[model samples]
Target: MFNYTMKDNCLAKKVILVTGAGSGIGRQAALTYAKLGATVILLGKTVQKLEQVYDEIIANGGAEPAIVPLDLKGATQQNYIDMSSTIAQQFGHLDGALLNASMLGELTPYTHIHQQIWDDTIKVNVTAQHLLSQALIPTMLKADNASLVFTSSGVGSKGRAYWGAYSVSKFATEGLMQVIADEYDESNLRVNAINPGATATAMRATAYPAEDQSTLATPEDIMPLYVYLMSDDSQNTTGQVIKAQ
Candidate 1:
C-alpha cells in the first residue's frame, strides 16, 4: 500500500469532484475526503446511490456534499462545460477531481469483442474523460494547487488477453493523463493516474467472480494514495502512475 499519514482536516475548505462516487472506491474516497474537511461533489449515474453517500457524509460530521447525476456514456462536451461553469460559480474554484468512473466491457477474445461494448467503453472511459478534463482544467487552475487524478489499471500500460475495450480505454486514459500532466507541468494544476490494484469491489467481482474476496484489499485499504494525491502532501508530484494495493 502507498504510505502517507493524513492529518485531520488536511483538505479543509477544498472543493473536490469525484466521478462514480456512488459506490466502491469512489464512494469510499468521497466519504474520506469529506471527513478530512473537503466539500465533495458526487457525480454518478445513480441518484439514489449519490443520495446515500450524501447522507452518509452528512451523518459522519463531514462537510455537506453536492451531487451531480450523470451517465458518462451519453454525456456531451457541453454537459461537462456547463458543470464546470456551475462549479466555478458555486465554489469559485476546484481543488481536485478524481476521474474514477470506468466501464468494463465483456471479457471476450479480441475477435469476439462486441461493437456496442467497445463503443460504450471508449465513450465513457476515454471520450468523456477527455471532455471533462478540458472543461475542469480552467476551474482547477483557479486554485493555488489542484490535482487531477485519473483512475487507471494494471493493464493500462501492459496489455492482457481478453480485456478488450476496457484495456484499450485505460491505455488512452494513461495517455491522456500524461498529456495533461506535461501540459500543466510547473503550473498550479498537477495531473496523475492511480491504479487501484485488485480491490474487493463490485467491479472486481464482476471481472473475476471466482476470486476469493476475503484475500483482496478493501477500498478503504487503498485510500492513502488517494488522500495523498488530493492533499497538499503531493503538490509537487505529477505525471506518475501510482499503484494502490
Candidate 2:
C-alpha cells in the first residue's frame, strides 16, 4: 500500500464519472472513489441500481454522487454529446472517467457469431466508449490533469477461442486507449487500460459458474489499482495495460 492512511477520503476536489456504476466493477469503482472523497458521477442502465450506489455513498458520509441512466449498447452520439454538455455545465470539468460498462455476447464459435450480437457488443464495448470520451474530452481538458481508464480483458491482448465479439471489442478498447494516449501525450490528459483478472463479479459468475467464487478477489479487493489509476499518484503513467489480480 502507498500508506496515505487512506483517510476514508483522499480524493478531495476530484470529480470522476464511472460507467456501469450500477453493479460489479463499476459500482465498486464508484464507491471507492467516493469513499476516497471524490464527487462521483454514476452512469449505468438501471436507475434503481444506480440509486442504490448513490444511497450507499451518502450513507457512508462520502461526497454525494450523481446518477445518469444510460444504455451504452443503444446510446447515440447525440446522447453522449448532450450528456457531456450537461456534465460541463454542472461540474465545469471532469478529472477522470472509468469506461467500465460492457456487454458480453453469448459465447459461440467464431463461425457462428450472431450478427446482431456482434454489432451490439461492438456498440457497447467499443463505439459507446469512444463517443462518451469524445463528449467528455473538452471538459476533461479543462482540468489541470485528467485520466481516462478503459476496462479491458485478458482475451483482448491475446485471442481466445469462443470469446467471440467480447474479445474483439476488448482489443478495440486496448487500441482506443493507445490512440488516446498518443493523442494526448503532450496534453494534460492521460489514457490507460486495466484488466481485472478472475474477479468475483456477476460477469465472472456468468462466464464461469463452475469456479469457486471464494478463490477470486472481490471488486473491493481489486480497488487499489483503480484508486491508483484515478488519483494524482498515477499522473505519470499512460498507454499501458495494468492488471489487478
Candidate 3:
C-alpha cells in the first residue's frame, strides 16, 4: 500500500464525480472520497449498485452522494452533455472526477475476438471516457484546481498475448491522460492515470479466476493514492502514471 494519510475535511466543499461507482475500485473511491469530505456523484450502469454505495456513504456519515445510473457501453456524447448540465445546475462546478469504469472484454487472441465485443469494449473504456471528459472540462474549469484521474491496467503499458481489446483500451486511456495533461500543463486542471495493481476486485477476479483472491490487495488498501491524487497535495502532479499496490 502507498504511504499517505488523509487529514479530516481534506476535501471539504469539493464536488467530485466518480464513474462506475457501483463496485470495485470505483465504489471504494466514491466512498473514500465522500468520507474525506467531498460530495460524491456516483455514476454506474446498475442502479442497485450505485444506490448501495450511496447508502454506505450516508451510513458512514460521509458527505451526501448523488447517483447517476448510466451504461457507459451505450452512452452517447449527448448523454454526457446532459449530465454536465445537471451537475452545473446542482453543484455549480466539479472539483474532480475518477474515470474508473471499464469493460474487460473476452481475453482471447486478437484474431479470435469478435467485432461486437471489440466495439463494446472500446465504446465503454475509450469512447465514453473521452466524451465524459469533453463534456466536463468546462465544469472542471470553474474550480481553481481540478483533478482528472483515469484508471489504467498493467497491460496498458505493454503488449500481452491474450489481453485483447481491454488492453488496447487501457493504452488509449494512458494516451488520453497524457494528451489532456499536456494540453492543460499551464493550468490548474491536472490529469493523471493510476494502475491499481493486483487488487481483489470483481474485475481482477474475472481476469484471473484461478488466482487466490485472498492474497490480493483490497480496494481500501490502495485508496491512499486516490486520496492523495485528488487532494490539493497533488495539484502539481500531472501526466505521470502512478501505480498503486
Local distance difference test values of all predictions, in order: 0.96, 0.91, 0.93
Per-residue C-alpha lDDT of model 2 across residues 1-245, encoded as one tens digit per residue: 22323455557889999999999999999998998889999999999999999999999998888889999978899999998888889998999999999999878999999999999999999999999989999999988889999999999999999999999999999999999999999999999999989889889888887999999989988888899888888899999999887
For candidate 1, the per-residue lDDT at 165 reads 96
- State, as a TM-score between 0 and 1, how close model 1 is to the true structure: 0.99
Q: TM-scores, in order shown? A: 0.99, 0.97, 0.98
Alpha-carbon lDDT of model 1 = 0.96
Off by over 4 Å in 3: none
lDDT score, candidate 1, position 73: 93
Task: Say which candidate scores most in TM-score.
Answer: 1
As a whole number from 0 to 100, the lDDT of residue 86 in candidate 2 is: 86
Per-residue lDDT, model 2, residue 197, is 90
Model 2 off-target regions past 4 Å? 1-8
Clashing pairs in 1: none
lDDT of 1 by residue, 138-197 (tens): 999999999999999998989999998999999999999999999999799999999999
